[model samples]
Target chain A: MAPIKNGRHLFNEVPVGYPVPGKTTVYDESETIDLETVPLNGGILIKALSFSIDPYMRGKMRAPTKKSYSPPYAIGEPLNNHAVGLVLRSENPSFKAGDHVWAFLPFQEYVVQTNVAHVKLLENKENIPWSNYVGAAGMPGQTAYLGWKIFSKAKKGETVFVTTGAGPVGSIVAQLAKLGGLKVIASAGSDEKVEFMKKIGVDVAFNYKTTDTVKVLEEHGPIDIYWDNVGGATLEAALDAANPYARFIECGMISQYNQTSPYGVKNLMNIVGKRLSINGFIVSDHMTPENAKDFYDTIPAMIAKGELVFLEDKKYGLDKVGEAILDVQSGKNHGKSVIVVAEE
Target chain B: MAPIKNGRHLFNEVPVGYPVPGKTTVYDESETIDLETVPLNGGILIKALSFSIDPYMRGKMRAPTKKSYSPPYAIGEPLNNHAVGLVLRSENPSFKAGDHVWAFLPFQEYVVQTNVAHVKLLENKENIPWSNYVGAAGMPGQTAYLGWKIFSKAKKGETVFVTTGAGPVGSIVAQLAKLGGLKVIASAGSDEKVEFMKKIGVDVAFNYKTTDTVKVLEEHGPIDIYWDNVGGATLEAALDAANPYARFIECGMISQYNQTSPYGVKNLMNIVGKRLSINGFIVSDHMTPENAKDFYDTIPAMIAKGELVFLEDKKYGLDKVGEAILDVQSGKNHGKSVIVVAEE
Candidate 1:
């Protein structure tokens, strides 16, 4: 066994609005150490297979503040994210060579995972692809599942309006609502994404960039539930279109995230007359182990049976991590954005 | 009997921002009639005792549109409100002469109640004063009761922030929250109201006119529940200071009701990260007969035991209805504003 070089992406500076490529630079730090030389301390050495790029990461790129849901990514430190990896070595004996695992790890070619709490060994009994863990069957999928179960609870036969229907969490939410017998209305930024939404069984899908969302909602909705992903004008549109006793699930406010001054929602008075309930939540706080089990027990089976479809916009190599994040931020990703760092 | 000349206030025009004195005018509509000449049509002829002037009436004074919680007052008709009265003559079998009743009747010296459904025979069995029915024991009391039961549901020991702490609905909500074992923090426009709140067992009371509500909240809270009466900047302040899983009860937005442009709520993004729930409700919709029973069963007893105190800002004469409404709007009323149409 010989020493191997590891490539990682480090957070260099706090971003003002949208993060650029220069904010983070690719760094390759080489050290020669194999599995045999690794000390046993309930940790595992692994090669990163794939990582997820999500809108929430943008919150972390801001200057370190207590207000954000997650801690700010420290400058000069490797940006960590949900990733799938192959465990080359394990000191704890719970994991071994060639074992596929999922953990919150950085954008690095190779790494030693010391926190046994975050690292979980994958069963792979059904031979589900490793990259799927970072996209569909992982955090995003769990997020979609719990969001419906806890926040929105958009009932069967009710009309649901979802924003950013092409994004990771929103797309999953839209599809699940469809599967649960809801009348799914979705909005996307591009015609291609609208078409994709339509293909995914959305009852009505519109390109928000080219259409007035309020008009679209008025035509297609008296929405019973609004699953908010992009929360500026779309939120106001939803407020205008909400029916009596409507429920609004506040997921992410991607539209307001980059702006210095957030869009002031003006139609909140409707909440009074219409008896609307607006609830915001972070999936990380709500998703328990039991919830994860419930998700894994049903969703993966549905995926294998073709009853559920998950799309991943795959980007290859560690160097493309910055670009992948920008794609998510700009709503350019066709579906869940994934950076494939290494081949299985 | 000689022709009983009746003086009543009529809604003359749609108010733009706030209802002015001239938007409604007192009219003397004299008609020759007697108790025997009153046609038997399930109705009761009554002499008015007292009637309420509420903040919600401001919303009704707006242009005739379907957007508000209630219908706009018909321009030429007398303005109707919750009133306590003495039944002078009765054609309906349910009511008889000398019986005291409460009904949604016009602001007049005398009236014939044709609609039997909206009238309820007063059961002042506890020897409760009839004028009290027009204030704390009536609509405003019911509004406060239902607001807490359905919307806020502030748990025992949780800190609850209430706006308009000296007004009708808010004052009752604050008192009830205290009785329910909550730490009550309240805001009022005047220092006198602040003192009133402090006297009513509020843990902390601040004059919002002189203080920053957000700063007050930051000092005393990570508020678990916010019972909003005055919306706008105070509502925005509540949003900023809400704790995780906080509940916001949107009872009224009196602050924005008269504004040409509503204040934009800017901190709504916090709803997601903090997992806060904001629910708006119309008390009329939630106050069912069963709810009224629950309220009457407990609240009246609490009042009798000196455990509860209700303040009434009573003005004499039907001609003063407009002035009373203005007082409620300007936050000049010490408590629930009531017009004594005639002496009981």
Candidate 2:
């Protein structure tokens, strides 16, 4: 512990726009967190074994209380994500020192915890990699399942369309839709991603770079459900292709982040003709801790049954966090980018 | 019967567009529909009575097809609407000869019916005016009600915003929202229509022609539900002001109809942040004979109590039919325009 040194690194504030590499200075402690060394009843401290860098974190960099579908992260606090860690100390009966767990923990080296309500205790399984804890067995996987299963209300023999079909959330979404008996169609930015989708159960996957989205979609008529990750043009194409009474689940919009450029949609009138139903979501906004179980349980079971495909683009360490995020931002990541902060 | 003499004069082929009025010769029938000479079918024969003209008939006029939302008027056939008529004969138990009925009938001298399924019998409604069968008491009323009530899933004390607020469908939607204990905000193209909305329960009304839709709606804070009868830019403004999980019941897009032009919505990415839902519908899409009961029961009672406002901008005589159609197309009708084919 840095208690003897009188100085330790803690996260200072939420960043906006492009954060300069390594300029984010972590301080000794944040004002809100109670790091009382005396262990409180049923409380523990966890040293993070694995950390995640996700696109959802980008949503949290604004004012904490923006009344949007997603709540913003607070300023001047250590960032936290779905992290798997080893319990270093515990007063909690369920957790002991050295027991492995996946808790919503900060991007810091250590997390002090109490009331392990949102934390899921992890048992080491040799066949499953630890990075998957922040991906397939964590939030993104659950998002893929719920967004496809409930949001789309996907029907058999219907076509399911998705944007960013190679990313963590959308790739899994397409896989789950395929398992649910729907024909899967997807759009990805690169040729590699398009082919990746085909290998993973997509019926039709088009490279947006070479293909006119509307033309490609028209070739595959009557999309019944659309699971959207890239918004703007792709979403417009989805709208244009939607049959009457289509359901559009807006899981993420990688297209509409910080920029001087405008977000314009030319085909909104299609929503009226098609009687489409679209909804935006931050999975955490609607999914509670118990619901998180529903997300994890179904997908892992699906994978165990050989009914789902899962992929992760893992970056070696915390040093590559910027590169990992940049890959997602540049539409280069084939799937979810996981930060292997400290290899288990 | 003079069918052998002037069969061509009685019916017309469908004209392609506005430059050519219709495909039949304008040979005048010197003799009009006569009650004494016409052979009436025993099942039911509706004497040409008052019928309702609606905005959506423009869509029908474009092309008669299975692909379209509604079947277009057939070539060489009289135009149809919500007609209120006197039944001269009926073999069906639901009606008898000389019974007054409200049904879907054409703009002809008399309509012979072998069956009467999609119809309502007018037994003792001598107290209410016959045209009321086509206005607040008819399809337009049902369009507004079912579109907002059932589709939008609108909740009381929440905000309901509608475009084209003073028109028959939008106007009644505003009233129904008000009755449901919601705050009603509406927009109309003209200052007079704004005044009309203000007169009938609209809490806030704007002349969209004069005001910036985005600015006006932002002033109203977040909109919980948008009942969009006029899409395009007004729908865009609604999208920006929509709260998370907002429902947009898209009943019509009259703003885009006259165009050799298509209007583009520029801010549709707000669907991701706001999580808005848009559904297009014809009141026909939701109507079951059972759901029709809510309209048939509540409307007469609402009219009797003077809680519902009904307006008609009538053009007198059969010759005025062409001008009336043109006027309604121009969006110049102050309210529902009916042609008086016979004396009341």
Candidate 3:
């Protein structure tokens, strides 16, 4: 086959606040790759299927000097995250042509995957949407599942408050808490997202933009658990409404990700008086083989049975990757933001 | 028996900042108690021995409308705290005359104790100082023990950073961490207190007043556990120095106790990236019969055997109660601040 155009989003500059679509990340289509003759070197060649754009990626677009759980995106390098791709050519036995695979893929249409260690073979036995693997059956889903399972310790009739309720992780956590016989109070930025929260059977859903977070919590909670996705003001409100021995699952803090000066949380003294347990975790740390197996064995089947539902904000093509990430960061994207590079 | 003057510290006013020694709390010796005729009502007549003046009491000096783990001190009432007393007479079968008893006692020279449920008989088998019962072997000791035991999850070779390292709770926690084979980094406000930390075998002791907290922690930490006694800025420094999955035992926040505006902790975002577990607790909550048994059985013996050591800042007489509490609130007290009303 002849050389083909390969479009990608490259880290152009370090962002001070919200990453600019063109400046922080530039869409470069000047690259070309020969599909049939590109050297695999005992590796697998993959055609990018879809990309999972998450709020955590915002933390990665920083100066390399700054340390975080995730590595910083180097200037002039392809910005990467959890992405699903179709294996087109295989020089390794583990991955064959036509097999779908998932890994931390760079934002590009075609890639030569030399490191197959972290790359996982996707088993879509339930035939869920290929993009769904990057959302509900993927990192965000496992995060919600393991975090809730391991940390929630939810008892019957207890209340849980989940922030960013319409997002993938928050939505799943809210649903799980509800299934575990909890009263779910959730918040979203927009009215539409709030409606989505209600549709998903959240007991109390509110638009944080218009409503006072503390008042809502005071009315609906003395929450037993807090699934904190957006930290800052929401976390303060959670602390105010927290019942004694409240468990706080600090999954993400999207609200502070882009701020030059992070929000100063004033009421953490409540953490002592209320005996609140605040646990911050990255899902990657808990992605043991046993946990991943359990997640895959249980979650995919639930999604297929329509018991666990997830919403996706689908953005077509690799060119839209920058916009998708920005949408996720700014809470413009209503659901799990996905960049579709090619049709399955 | 003849009538005796009962000097006490009464809550005269609710304070906004630091409680005024005479205004917020007034020294009252106006009431004379007839020791023989005063009705105990089928309870015990006790002579107050010593009072524990701790930072948590500052929180209780707030307006009654505010809620907390410990109830607020009502105006025109005697300010109470963990105290040791000698029972002069007893009608209850559980206690006898001349027995040393410990309970939450008012800062008075004499008292008629009717409620004996919460009161405990102090068995000073090792012949330890009676004031030590209200300091190390009392609530602060149990707090240090339980908070460290239940929350720390510390492993050998791990590092623990303790603030207020010379206080009753911090001192015990520091010693416990050291005994558990963890590297202990402790901070105190004064040079003398830092010297005490060094005496108690803290691996790295620093005067937070003279040396920078962040600088010291950076030099010796990446701490696995933080026994947080003084919250505010020190808590921020601990967060910065935290290793992944750091355990924060939020025992107290003396730094923010008297502040009109609580410190706005800016780097709580590090909580998520570092996968920190911050747990706040009141020692009373964990003082289950079983836990209390374990604590009394283990800790008192440790202190007696010289495996654990504690220091006390003894202020003589009921008139000094207000000053003692002031010393505690201001970090002026070198050790556990105790007001000695009478000798054992």
- Candidate 1's residue-wise lDDT over B245-304, tens digit each? 899998788898888898888778888888888888887786678987888787767667
Overall lDDT per candidate, in order of appearance: 0.83, 0.71, 0.90
Q: Candidate 2, residues A208-278: lDDT per residue as tens digits?
A: 88988889788986689888887777787787788888988887777766433656776666766677777
Tens digit per residue, CA lDDT, model 3, B1-344: 88978898899998889988888899999989998898889999989989889889999998788888888898988999989999998889999998998888887888888899999998888877888888789989999999999999989999999988888999999999998999999999998888889999998998988999999998998899999988898999999999988999998888898888889888888889999999999989889999999988888888889888888888898788778788889988878888888786
Ranking by lDDT: 3, 1, 2
lDDT of candidate 3 at residue A208, scale 0 to 100: 90
Model 2 chain A poorest ten-residue lDDT run: A1-10
Cα displacement (Å) at residue B146, model 2: 1.8
In Å, residue A88's CA in model 3 sits off its true spot by 1.4
**Docking band of candidate 3:** high
Most DockQ-accurate candidate: 3
Question: Model 1, stretches more than 4 Å misplaced?
Answer: A24-33, A124-126, B24-33
Please give, as one word, the docking class of candidate 2: medium
True contacts kept of each: 0.80, 0.63, 0.90
> What TM-score would chain B receive for each of the candidates shown?
0.95, 0.88, 0.98
